[model samples]
Target: MQIGITMFATDYAIPPQELAVEAEQRGYESLWFPEHSHIPTSRRSPWPGGPDLPKWYYDTYDPFLALSAAAVVTKTIRLGTGVCLVVQRDPIYCAKEVATLDRLSDGRFLFGIGGGWNAEEMEDHGTVFATRFKLMRERIEAMKEIWARSKPKYAGDLVKFDEMMQWPKPVQKPHPPIIVGGGFPHGARRAIAYSDGWMPIGGRGGDTLAMLPPFRQLLKEAGRPESEVPITIFGVGMDGDALKRARDAGVSRVVFGVPPEARDKVLPLLDKGAALMRDA
Candidate 1:
C-alpha cells in the first residue's frame, strides 16, 4: 500500500512547494490538494461535517496552481487534486489545464474529481444542482475525447463542441488517472463506468472497507476488469488499525490529511507516517 498526504493549501499554511519537497524526501508517494473555486457565504447548504464548516475551505488556494508549484519542487512524488469540482468549470478549459499540468509535472498528475455538494455554489456557475452529476459525466467524457483525439469533437446533451485543435496532450498515456471522488454506490458506479479509480472520502458516513467489494462487483457488472480500477481512501488520519483494515480490504492508497501549519511542525508528522508505512 502507498501512503500519501492531502492538504487544504490555505494562505496561512506552509507553502505547497516546501511541503512537496519534504514529502518527497520523506518517501511519501503523493501530495494532493483539494479545491473550492470559491465558497459561497450564503450558508444555504448545511456543512457536511457539521454546522460550522472549516475556515480553510474558504481560504484555500486553487488546486491546479498549488499542485503546479509542488510539481516543480519534487521529482518523484505524484501531484493531485484530492477532489476537483468538475461541476463548476468548463470541460474544455479543464482539459487544457489537466494536460498542461501533466506535461509540466512529467506525467505525475492524478485528476481526482467529483460532483460537489454545494448547491448554491453550483448555481453561481449556472449548473442546476439536480443535473450536476449528468453534466459532470458529460464534461469528463468530453475532456477525454479532447485529450485522446487530434481534432476532437463531442456532442452530448450537456456538452457539445465542433472539431477543434488542442495541443500538448497529457504526458501520461490515455491521460492522467481520473479518480472519481465520493462515497458508495453512485460514485463507485460512475468510477467503474468511466474513471480510472475510485477515491472514497474517509470519516464520512461511509464504510471504505465495506464499499470495496461492491465497487469491485460493479466493475465486473459494467464489463470492466476489476483490476483496472484502484481504490483510494481520502482524508485518512494516522490510525494503524484503520490503515491495516483498508489495506487488507484492497485499498491501493491512503492519503492522510495534513493540517495547515508551518513546515517544521508538519514535516515530522509526514516523515513519521511515511516511516510507519515503509516499515509495514
Candidate 2:
C-alpha cells in the first residue's frame, strides 16, 4: 500500500513546500493538504472528530495554493487535496485551478473531494446544507466536463455553464483521479457513481479494515470492479500491524496526519513514519 502524509497547512506550520520536499526525500509517496476556505465563528455545527474544532481547521491555507507550492518544490511526491469541499466552490474556476496544478505537477495530482459537514460554512458559500450532496455531485460532473472537453458546456440543476473555453487542461488523461472522501455506504456509493477512489476517515464509525468486504460487495452490486474504486483511508496511525492489515485488506493507500507544527516538531514524526513505512 502507498503511504502518504496530510497536514492542515496553516500559516504557522512547516510550510507546504518544505514539507513536500522533506516527505519526498524520506520516501513518502504522496503529500496532501486539506481545504477549508474559512471556518465560521458561529460554531453551530458539531465537529465529527470531537466536541471542539481544532485550531488548525480555522487557520488552514487554501489547499490549491498550498499544493501548488508543494508541486513546484517536489518532483515525485503526488500532491492531493485531502478533502476539498466542492459544494462550496465555483466549478469553473475550480476546474482551471485543478488543471493548472495537474499541469504544473506533470500529472502527479490526486483530487480528494467531499460534501463538507459545516452547515453555516456551506451557507456562507451560498450552498444549502441539506442539498449540498447533490450540489457537490453536479459540481464534480461539471468539472469533469471542463477537463475533458475544449469548449465544455454543462447544465445541471445546481451547476450550469455554457460552452466555455479554458486552457491548460490537466496532464492526466480524463483528468486527475477523483477520490471521494466520506464514510461508507453513502461515500462509497458516490465514489462508485462518479469518482475513481474512496477515502474514509479511520476510526470514524468502526474499523476501516472491517468495511472493506462490504464496500467491495457494494462495488459488485453496482457492476463496478473493486480495482476501479480503490480504498484510501485517512488519519491512519503509525502502527506496523495496522499498516499490514490495511495492505492485506487490499487498500490502495493510507494517509497519516501530521499536526500543524514547526519543522523541528514535524520532522521527527516524519522520520518515525518513514521507518514504519520501511517496515510496513
Candidate 3:
C-alpha cells in the first residue's frame, strides 16, 4: 500500500513546499492538495460536510499553483489535486496547466478530478448543476485530446473546439494518470469510462468491498481490463482493520488527511502515518 498526505492549502497553514519536502523526506509517496476556486458568500448550497462550511474553503490557494510549488521542492514524490473542480474550469486552459506541471514535475502528476457538489459555485462557473457530470465528462475528454494529439479538435454538447496546436506535451506518454474522485457507483462508472484510476474518499457510506466487483464489471464493460484501473482511498485515517479491508478490496493507494496546523504539529503525524502504511 502506498501512503500519501492530503491537505487544504490555505494561506494560514504551513506552506505547500515545506509540507511536500517533509512528506518526501519521510518516505511518503505523494502529496495531494484540495481545490476550491473561491467560495461564494451566497450560502445557497448547504455544506456537504455539515450544516456550516469551514472558513478554509474560502481561503484555500489554487491547487495547480500550490502543487507546482510542492513539485519543485520535492523529487520522486508525486503531486496531485485531491479533487480538482473540472466542472468549473475551461478544459483547454486546464489541459495546458496539467501538461506543463507534469513536464516540470518529471511526469509525477496524478490528475484527480470531480464534479463538485456546490450548486451556486457551479452556477458561478456558468455550469448547470443538473448537467455538471456530463460537462465534466466532456471536459475531461476534450482535455485528453489536447494532451494526446498534436493538433486536437473536440466537438460535443458541452465542449466544442476547432483543431488547435499546443506544445509541451506531458512527459507521461498519453498524458497523466487521471484519477476520478467521488463515491460509487456513479463515480466508479465514470472512472471506468475515462479515468486511469478511481479515488474514493473513505467513510463515504459506500460498501468499499462490494464496490469493487461492480467497478471491475464496469471496467470490463468499457472494454478496459480490470487490472488497468487503480482504486485509491482518500482521507484515510490510521486504522489497522480498515487498512486491511481496503487492501483486501484491492485499493492501491491510501492518502491520510493532514490537519491544517503548524508544520511541527502536523509533520510528526504524517511521518507516523507513512511509517505505518509502509509497514502495513
User: What lDDT score is found at residue 118 in candidate 3?
Assistant: 89
Where does candidate 3 clash, by residue pair?
none
lDDT of 3 at 211: 74
lDDT per residue for candidate 2 within 18-43, as digits (tens), equals 99999999999999988888888999
Q: What is the TM-score of each candidate against the true structure?
A: 0.97, 0.99, 0.96
Candidate 3 regions exceeding 4 Å error are none
Backbone clash count for every predicted candidate, in the order shown: 0, 0, 0
Full candidate order by TM-score, most accurate first: 2, 1, 3
Worst 10 residues of 3 by lDDT: 203-212
Shift in Å, residue 209, candidate 2: 1.0
Please give the lDDT score for candidate 2: 0.92
Q: How many backbone clashes does candidate 2 have?
A: 0
Instruction: Show the colliding residue pairs in model 2.
Output: none
**Prediction 1 global C-alpha lDDT:** 0.90
Stronger candidate by TM-score (2 vs 3): 2
